[model samples]
Target chain A: MDIATQTETAPPPPPPATTEQQRASRGATRPGDRIFLGLSRGSGIVLLVIMAAIAAFLTYRAALALSDNTGNFLTTFEWDANAIPPKFGIAVLAFGTVVSSIIALVIAVPVAVGIALFISHYAPRKLAVPIAYVIDLLAAVPSIVYGLWGALVVAPNLTGFYSWLDTVLGWTGIFEYQGGAPRSLMTVGILLAIMILPIITNVSREVFLQAPKMHEEAALALGATRWEVIRMSVLPFGRSGIISASMLGLGRALGETIAVATVLSPTFLISASLLDPGGGTFAQNIASKFNEASEYGRDALIASGLVLFLITLLVNGAARMIIARRKEYSGANA
Target chain B: MSTTAPTAQAVTPDTLHAARLPRWTSPLVAIGSAAAAVGIGLAAGLHSRVQWGLIAAVLFVIASYVLATAVEGRRQAKDRFATSMIWVTFLLAVIPLASLIWETVERGSKVFSPYFLSHSMGVVADQDPGGGINHAIIGTLQQVALASLIAVPIGLLTAIYLVEYGRGKLAKAVTFFVDVMTGIPSIVAGLFVLSFWILILGFDFSGWAGAMALSILMMPVVVRSTEEMLKLVPNELREASLALGVPKWRTILKVVLPTAIGGITTGVMLAVARIAGETAPVLLLVWVNPFINTNPFDGAQGSLPLYIYQQYAAGSEASYDRAWAAALALIGFIMILNLVARGIARWKAPKTGR
Candidate 1:
């Protein structure tokens, strides 16, 4: 056929030299290329402008609140938004955010890693796909739904567990329950863990699945068992991914609002015992009190929001750095 | 050498057979012996009934594992056990999702009649609480639609600029800020809108304020999704359009937009869904009202999320039913949107490869 002849002749054509010929045919500064380059260059510039504008605005407003504050912005515990000469600090909020997020990361990371391992290494193809789909669905479940579920279902169920923890781990201040029926930092942590589990699992599963098959096979061929093969081949490859997933989960937990606000009984005091139920996270306190706050009160809350924004930025920045370093380890040319 | 090979092979057969024998047998036997020992020691450390249950469960598991290994060998038994654990995990995930949906539907079924859909809370009192969520439903649609109108264009355009034209300092700065925006708590968006529009712009309790709050939360999602989808619009396609003498902007609008429309629409719908169920922002921006407020620029409006929040917070039995009903409505709406997006994506996905 003519098609077969053309295909046979195609490779014989001097296609490589045609590009050089075209370059000679067309001079530089063609309008088409110029426009293309301009548009591409322009987009990046626009993105920077938008970011600068936002930062400028936030900084302008934040400065208004920080200019006259008496206490150290980072360490003072009291958040007296209603004071005549309003004094506010983020120590308690910062503590709550960090503690809750740390708890969430600790509780979720292992289970998420386990689930990811199960999906990537253990489950059959058909079953793994469906389970992964289900986790995606969990990730898409609205935060407000989680909040409602936490308030209605999870909080009520915590009473017996809290009592059991008090009985068993009473000597450990962290688990000592102070007889509060429904509201505790432990409850918030559990809720946050559940909320963030899907994200970590989804990310970590992808990373685990991407581990080189040859590495796994080599381990197995060396007489190692399946679990040992996974331990050696997959876990090491996905360590950075696990760390990134945890940081992503931590970012989410640090800023989660509705669920924590609905579930936590925040009373503006930090306690070593998670069961003592008396701390307010930056996001939760803002959500709980922002509507009723006066002008100065709103400013105080804005100050807290600034802290949260910074924390999330720091967490995500750290994650990005870890991922960048991991690319180097994996020799990803990208 | 042949004679030596035969002797070596003969010696290896015993060890090879032992290796091929059920690896799980030893563990099962060890667990069985441990359980028996625990049973004998149960009286000293624990209550009789709990200890007996624990002992019985452990003994039953060990017995099953032993029987399986005996009948089917170690590999099959181990595979079966691992498979069952996978099923257990899947079931654990499914149970909560199924229960949540089942409970919502079951509780909300009482108020899911056509009359409920058509009628507003105009006829219902706070105490009576027997009417529908027409006001909240309408407010949800209008305000969310308005927010989409505001957010989608700006977000999509920003994404376009970032993908097509952005570079240098401006692009880097925008990327950073958008990242920051992505992490902004919903409440902060609410507060931002509240302070900016209400205090500074001198507006009070308008659905516009709610739209603003929702838009702030929605923009980052829209931008991220759009950016991703636009990135997927292949460079070859743009080059092809350019080769045909299409202007850059025209190529983006006509060729690139059409090419990526499926994903863009899905992303936009997802962003809508993300903001639609938001309560904290809506609560801070819009005033609660049972009556329908059709105008976003005007007075107080009630949304489904706000309705659920208020009704649930009220804690009255009747109001609780309404709260559940509204929750159901919201979930149903989101589900329908997701299904529609999926359907559209399937229908419009470009055909490739014979």
Candidate 2:
């Protein structure tokens, strides 16, 4: 009884028409606000639903290929998808994708970083904008154009380089040439590198440009040369961004189709030598076989595509995580 | 900010002091001038031999400018060197674009007559490959339009959701997945559609399937571009609309969208241009029909990209010419769309006081 009386006495000090209560009462009937919130929430839900649907559809179809008896899908190399028992696997495709993309990264990253650094630090203001524009134009060039150019111009020119590599570095398995004209993994890698170079360069240039001017000046003031200043100030600040850019380029290279198909003449075998003119990527296999594929053959190709899709997804996801963590490095904020 | 000035000042002093020393400055300039003169004389002699005087002169000028920069201090020589480089970069970009355009126009001029537009490729045979791209043009329009219809709304809505309401786990997952989708190869997308719709579901090669494949490529681009444009929309507009008791979707459609319409159109046009040139995916999913098919769900249909691919694959000189013509036509269409997008952006951009 005493507690109840004390509580009542204390609460009675504030009127029934308190400010908070009045505000809450007034907010309850705001149908317009509720409607807006509902719409926004509904749109988000719809996006989630669509993503779920895509996953469901892909998994449902992928199941057909996965259910078949094969000695695990990743180990076997023969893509005799038309066999009555259908013995097939993705080892060649996986090897091809990883090898080509790795080569592309190896070739593209250094040049891309150099060009980015040149543009951001060395080039004068008048030259910088135009160079940047050129890079943008390069990025906008269609993949088919690049493929056509690669097939006609680059492939023919690579024959000389391939022979040179064979003559010089033949002891290393990777550079050993089996005397193919020009259709080889090395040529494909070069084409992939050219295709992805613009993207990596553009992203890295933006990141490098965003490096703190004061930090650079500080390094310079300590008697560091221009290159040393860049090394001390820009490289550390933009390292994660450069990684993200390379990952994005790698993702694109891994999944590129027409260019790989046009440039590579695969013989359905894997070799350590990039000059062997063998091994097929998932995208290249799908493109080459889709025109005349039988039913089971199509399913097998789709299964390979599923693997490619998952790999690209993993790569892009990692890129996004890196980019997200290093958002401050991006020039957009500046 | 205040601290930055001292370091900048300190760095500038040593470089400035070194620059002021004028060590071997006049001799360096004289030697550079002499080298330039010799180079010009040699180039002129070669030009006389080759009958290319203009090329020689331009090369001489470039060589002189580079030499001047090396001999002179950067402050005196940087401008000319930088200007020359800018021009070189511009030329590098313009040359291919111009060559591509010129080659296409030269080849396509043979078939740019009115009848070429009216007649279908059905009449043309391998023996005499000179009918028209009428069927291909129609098929391309229909398929790309259908792809846009499928991709645009979904992509735009997803972008809207991502930009406006997305916050936690689902949004991050969707963003990550969309990035993955963006990197997917066009041929693989075709394979996915072909296996699912044709092989498993027992459907035939139709324009609908081709559109589906294109949508797979187009969707992520549209979503990414639209999301970027939407993000550029100011947050104050949303708050203002919300304060005025407007529904969120309505505000997005009316206020946010109108504000970003210019960028959105550009993004959409770019996406269309991107998918329109896809050959591998359409080749895999849709059969090449000689005649036009209006119904996307019906029989096979021809598209510009596939037409070009087929003609080039024929490995004949005449067919290669036709391929170049088709390439021209595709480039023309994309350029027109780009021009229109630019025009729209210019028209819609907010006016500012002069």
The model with the greatest DockQ is 2
Question: Residue-wise lDDT of candidate 1 within B1-354, one digit each (tens)?
Answer: 768988887776665433344667646655675567576656466444434544554554556556667775675456545443444444545655776677778877767777777667776776675777888888999999999997887788778878876767767566666665666667767766665677556788888889988987788788887888788887778777767756666778888888888988988888888788888788878878878788878988988887877776677777777777777888888877776876776776643312
Which regions in candidate 2 have their CA more than 4 angstroms from the true location? Answer: A1-55, A69-72, A171-173, A176-181, A221-225, A328-334, B1-16, B19-119, B126-128, B244-248, B339-354
DockQ for each candidate?
0.25, 0.26
**Model 1: residues >4 Å from true position, as ranges?**
A1-54, A66-77, A83-87, A324-334, B1-92, B119-128, B165-180, B350-354
The Cα local distance difference test for each model comes to 0.74, 0.73
lDDT of 2 by residue, A234-320 (tens): 999999989999999998899888778777888778888898687888888888776776666777777777778778878887887
In terms of TM-score, which candidate is strongest?
Answer: 1
Model 2: share of native contacts present?
Answer: 0.30
Q: Per-residue lDDT for B1-354 in model 2, tens only?
A: 999998997776554443332546435644555565557668656423222433443554465455556654454354444444434333434444454456567766765666766667786764365766788888889889999998887788778768876778868777776776777767767766776688668898888999988987888888898888788787777778867766566778898898888888888887888888888778887889978777878989888878876766666666666666777677778767766776776776532212
lDDT of 1 at B180: 59
What is the docking quality class of candidate 1?
Answer: acceptable
